[model samples]
Target: MNDEHDSAFDSVTSWIVAALGLLVLVLVWGVIFTFTVYSQALGDAFGLSSLRLSSIFSITTAAFYIAGGTIGILIARVPLRPVVATAGAVFGVAIGLLQISSSYLGLAVVFGLLGTAGGTMFVIVISLVPQWFEQYEGRAMGITMAGNGLGIFVLPPVWVWLLERTGIREAFVVVGGATVLVILVAAVVYRRPPELRAQGTAPVDVAWLRSNLTDGRFVSSLVGFALLWSWYFLLSADLVGILTTGGISRAVAATAFGIVGGVSVVARVASGEFADRIGMRVTLAVGTLLAAVGMVVLPWTGTEPLMYVLLVTFGIGLGAIAPLFSPIIIERFGPANATAIVGVFTVAEAATAFLVPIGLNLLLGVTNGYVVPLLTVGGLTLLGAGLFYRGTAPKTSPQL
Candidate 1:
């Protein structure tokens, strides 16, 4: 097994396949995250209120996060290739279903399916990277997770061009078909880590999960993750609105938001390497602190230049979180249960995704200004960073 692991580590084929997996994740999440751009068009077509439109988006994101737990369970009991391929197919089909959706309810169902498929693929692919590289796990996961930032940056413009040229329904069909084709082909290239091939059937460890749930460190990490993730989702959903409300022009606000995405691409890769060298805990704390600072200064930025500075700060910090999750879990719990633990963590993230935006909206209503809410979120992010720092501290001794 050691020899097999060595052979697979940094092998040419494994690296190429890992790159393809990154591409797959990019395409999958690119489509999902672009929902922010599409929501307006969807609202116009369906005569939906902003609240209803937001609810639809929330449903998809929540579904994606919640599905991670079930995906973890399935992957533990089944082979990787079949499960991943099936998820890709389902995702492709779900995207296609969006083309013919006539009612808001119908679209919600399709998006829900799409979210589930995307979530399952995300869990499997992230888990697979650790198995492929021993020394470069953080770097590999960083490269792979960078896809999320890339998708957020790249997809909106592409979708906008498509929507302008092809119109909404036609754009859906064309993009859906193309995405499906790529997913099916990528599925063939994805292979399990060589180390796991000899282990005939992976067993589901229910007791391990129960004990982990009871662990103080794990629970603290989960809460911290939830807080940071909530901040991420809230920023994504409301940044443009926040900027526009603060008297920034729409075009400038949108470009500033785009800069966040662009800066994040660099931030993700750089932080990954840094994590590998220094440590994930230190990297994550620094990133979260940057995000907190950005959030605190966000509402006060009065010019485009200041906005860019704020966003770049926040984006770099936000970008670091995704790549760190798998590595941190593996370090804390061991590889055997990393996927399961991540699944539970993802579900907590999903719950935060659902509640944060709504809670912020209510906060804004009560305060009649963005300052208080932004400050509140920023404070929570800092608190999360502190909790994570505490949770990851070296254990002093056996408690019992």
Candidate 2:
């Protein structure tokens, strides 16, 4: 009877963690990615150039992962509730600061704050879900990450409506406040499992990471992540711009972008479940390959219908790839090493987020087309797929 009761309680708590994790990703990643929708509005308001506009996103993204990886070290050793709550407070306030900033530098600084806090919250939320379940870990991670897809899908249209009605300033104020409130509530409710809470682990150190470097699997995963994220950010930084420039209406382009996110919602759950059956290595590789194929063909698609179809393909890969990061890491390194290991991958992600967009945008300026840069994205992502397959643990490996 006691065993049954414990099992029931664990089931309830696990789903709760999944639910909150979903909510957090919706707001955090959703708000961040919605920059694409608002980039035009921001540019119009500030008289900014494309390079300058991309820089704002680059700054935020780079800061986000860099902070996630750096601060994640500290978080591994400390109590989580206070740190996450403080991060929530900081994220909401920084977003609110966007309303008053008129200058490029000011906006960059403020967004850097948003990225830092959001990154912290994001990593924490992602880290927590896996601790709750062993059997459905992939699915849980997928479900949680689907919030990102949902947010991207849902928020753009909402932001469009809000921007039209209230303008960007008021939108920021309302949305920022709401984000703060939700994160605070989640922080209060989301706790580590008792088993995890009871473990008194030491902070991860450089020497330990150095030793892990000797493992080819670990290094391969890191390299694959960096390359994969480079491809992702390359597209993200300019997909809307590509559509608009291709003679598609802004509304249509936004819809296409949302299509990617919407499809990703399904892909996230499906890929997670599929990974459980066939193995995450195969799932990861196939997803990346699909995205690559879509990306390679995207520059050739002149019509709206084809663009939408290709984006759906890309979305599946996007959804599948993002959720596997933690699962793969935890599988190889163990849960105790999960947070710190993820932080290292976050650093790789940060490098790509910071540099890839800027580089691609610059390449676009030189080439006067998306052809070369996008082709580069496709090729690199294919390489990423191979690397992930090389690095990921096979299904036959003993479960941690």
Candidate 3:
């Protein structure tokens, strides 16, 4: 491990670079989260069923998470600048292509590309956090991840306004151009700590990763995390639809969804501070329980005030989980293999993301209401909380 007293640790340049990386995440995810706003527009334009439209998001989300596994390995080997710049460029192109997409297949293809780019960008930026800070790792991670919540909070409403003024195609063009510029600039500013750069890329220890994977506690933790993420993916993808179907105006629904983003910003940073004090396991369990409560109450929230309350409660849980991902992995496995370990965890999440949205959409088709599906998700979230609580047993292996 790098010495705590190294100049890079909590240095001004380090924080500046971290902030730029945070902005990169904001730009990348800002575009992706706008899907909630765009779904209605695209559905009307293409005359597509909800199931079909959801498939695009499901596929993209799955790709995004699954790509993390491979991208994590690449980040370990390659320089950060080229990898990030290329990912930004690819993501920009994919968004630009959305302007010309006339068919479902084309949209799906471009979205998948966008997903891959998002996954690459996310893993690279997040993995760098531990290398830069030792004493305040959790706080740094929390601040960085708050950008995700910030993006989700800020982007959807703007996208809705842009959609109204410029139409969907033109909005895509504008968002795509802006995303490319922001990402490239951020990429230039991101740098590995001097200590890490001096050491060069350490070869990944396959045996270590394999052994960790086989640990019962580690496996359980991954499963529990995946279940919690299943609820997140579904809620993020369907929140707008659920509200609109219940007779809320589109503008109001978008604002309500933005509230989730807004609440998440606070939840993420606060949870990180809490985790640094209490422990990741306890923090995770608390967050998951809150999420379960929010999900269970969501279906009954018919009035606007009740809906906002549920969104705030749910958002706290949603935001809390993001910063915890790296801390949990680093706590268990150490920073040497943090990216790869988190990548494996994300692959599990990808599997859940692949299945949950489609299953929820199908359930909605059969039942014609969200009650059953929401309840099931809530129940699963509770189960995840229990598993996570149980899985944080004493570590059996030495840190690599």
Candidate 4:
């Protein structure tokens, strides 16, 4: 009876907790989607060359990730909600600055420096739930993780349309205004879980992380994650151009990406729940294989039916990866150091995100097209699948 009672309560709390995390993700990505669109327009307004425009995204992205790692460390030491609120305030200011500044140098400073200031807040939200909830981690993480897609779903079209009507300067003001409202909502509800509250101090278990580094399951997970992210970053930064070159129009490309982003919300949740019911290794391998299939078809997908099929296929895989990755941290590292380990992982992710996109840019610079780049993404994901299979613990090996 007590067990049943505890589980019922746990279920309720978990859903609520996940919902809070999801809300934070939505607003974070909402601002992020809008920011990226606005920055691109700012570059266009000034007649910056393609190389110069890419540089702004490159710098903003690089700084965002490197800072994300540091922000994770900070969250481990501080109250989680305050960090988010502070980040929100800074994000608000960064957007406001764009309203006044129009030069490339000005955009770089505001986005690169001021933008990075509120950067960690979103990272903390994404990272915290994994530590707080363990057993239902995937489902919870998936639901919360969907917040990003939710924003992508709701925000991008709105952004494009708004920018169409209002222009870039006003877009910045609107994006910043939205951030202020959402962050305030998140700040009030995004508290640490009761389990962590019982402990008081943040979890920082060094031994667990050291164990994880040596453990086969954890290592496999890392490799798989690296592959997954490499593909994701590559596509995210280049999708519009890549598909368009294949003969799709810019308007169609935008709509396709918007649909892809929207579909991710459902995909994230389904994959998370599936992982919980089955196991992370099996679920991830299956999801990744499907993602690889989509990659294979992407370059070849020219006709309308095939194009729509590939779009949904690619989204299905991309959406599932994140929720699966985040919620498992506590299982390996424990509550203590969960955030710190995630930070280290973020540092790794940040590096991959920067390099992968930069690498794509270079490939485009040389080849003037995306064939090789798309092929690389598919190949890496398959390679990662093999690496993951080999890295799993032997049935005889003791579990970490």
Candidate number achieving the greatest TM-score relative to the actual structure = 1
Collision count for each candidate, in order: 0, 0, 0, 6
Q: What is the C-alpha RMSD of each candidate to the true structure, in Å?
A: 3.1, 3.8, 4.4, 4.4
lDDT pick, better of 2 and 3: 2
In angstroms, the error of model 3 at 123 is 1.7
- Per-residue lDDT over 92-112 for candidate 2, one digit per residue giving the tens place of the 0 to 100 score: 668767777889988888889
Candidate 2 to native Cα RMSD, angstroms = 3.8
Q: For model 4, how does the per-residue alpha-carbon lDDT over 1-400 read when each residue is reduced to its tens digit?
A: 1334323323555565567667766766776555556666777776777788877766776666778666675567577678667777877778777778868888777677543653575566666666655567777777888988887667777788888898777876776677676676667656656556557664445764577679777677567666666777777777777777788778778677667777778898898888878986667777778778777777765666777888787778777776766555445445554556566667778767768877888887898767777888888888876665455534455654
TM-score, one value per model: 0.88, 0.85, 0.81, 0.81
Q: List the residue pairs that clash in candidate 2.
A: none
lDDT (Cα atoms) of all candidates against the true structure: 0.75, 0.78, 0.76, 0.69
lDDT of 2: 0.78
Clash-forming residue pairs, model 4: 203-336, 203-337, 204-336, 204-337, 205-336, 205-337
Expressed as tens digits, the lDDT of each residue in 1-400 for candidate 3 is 2335345577766677668767877877887766777888877776779999988877777778887567776466567778778888887788777777889998888889888888877887777775677667667778889888777767777888888887777777787677778778867766667676666655666876677779777777778878877678787668888887767677888777678778888887898788778876678778888889888887776678878888888888877777876666666655665567667777787778778888898999999999999999999888876765566544753333
Error of 1 at 192 (Å): 3.8
Q: Write the per-residue lDDT of candidate 1 for residues 1-400, one digit (tens) a residue.
A: 2445446676665576568667867777777778878777778877889888887877777778887556765576566667777877887777677777778798788888888888887777777676677677778878888888788777778889887876666776766666667667767765556455665443557776677678888777778888876567778778888888877898888776677777877887888899889988889889998888888888887777788788888778867877887767666765654466667777777777778888899998999988998899988888887766676665773432
